[model samples]
Target: TLPVLAEPRAAQDLGDWLRELQAFNLSAREHAHTPLSDIQRWGGQAGQRLFDSILVFENFPLEDALASAGRSGLRFETQGSTGLTEYEMDVEVSLRQTLRLSFTYMRRAFDAEQVAAICAQMMALLGAMGTSPAQTVGSLSLLGPDEQAALLALGQG
Candidate 1:
């Protein structure tokens, strides 16, 4: 995994932001083998985790691998717990025929409601970006009409 520093400007459009991210990812790939500890130390963040959340985009051909394993009389079973999550949240995006977004979050740090809101916001943002890639990052609205109306009602009170 590459440790990339995503510094996107609010005034930038989604397309621009994506391009910048792509460029950073390409550059970071060169140093992908660098130790995370070394990166943390170099960034003056020694003994501290750089990020609390991670997004994993998986596009591997797992079906083929599973088929091969089955042919060899080896069955694979999914484990309920890996027992290793240094981050507070993990978003796994599985790119199959349909996109699947799975979130694993620390219960102590966040409740189900908060995670649900975050998921809703993410879906809204993605929908907005898809519809209008030229829209500026700051101009993008994370709230729906009902949410905006509710907030407005509270503010007016």
Candidate 2:
């Protein structure tokens, strides 16, 4: 999924941006699916390995019909302590293409709780910006009382 990392001050134009992104994704899919007339050959080093991971997101309105036609579930075991990591994330969007939620799955790279907390902060930021899109990003109250308290404690350290 495309990551739309936007500032609170840009919230006033978020709807427009999402609409554009939706159109872009559709066009990109169409182009990607078209058969290539000539295949290009590439050379790589021996023993190169490609890794795969599964990600799943709850039902959302913006998902393609084919992708959401049946029940959604993901179950897999992650490799332990690899020096490098592969990207794995899932994002849910509203009918209007507005981002609603995200899940980052990387056992070796990041703490799940911390990632979830960041997602919560994102939701709070979106809510605050939705109400006052004209406000500066720094002026927005993106953190709840608990998060604020934690931040203050960190500052005291």
Least lDDT summed over 10 consecutive residues: which range in candidate 2?
Answer: 36-45
lDDT, candidate 2, at 131 = 81
Q: Which candidate gets the maximum lDDT versus the true structure? A: 1
**Which pairs, if any, clash in model 2?**
none
User: How would you encode candidate 1's per-residue C-alpha lDDT over 14-68 as one tens digit per residue?
Assistant: 8989998888777887898899899999999999888888888777857667878
Question: Pick by TM-score: which candidate is best?
Answer: 1
Q: RMSD of candidate 1 to the true fold?
A: 2.2
Q: What TM-score against the true fold does each predicted structure earn?
A: 0.86, 0.42
Question: Which ten residues in a row are the worst by lDDT in model 1?
Answer: 77-86
Assess the local accuracy of residue 119 in candidate 2 as a C-alpha lDDT between 0 and 100.
77
Q: What Cα-based lDDT does every candidate model obtain?
A: 0.82, 0.52
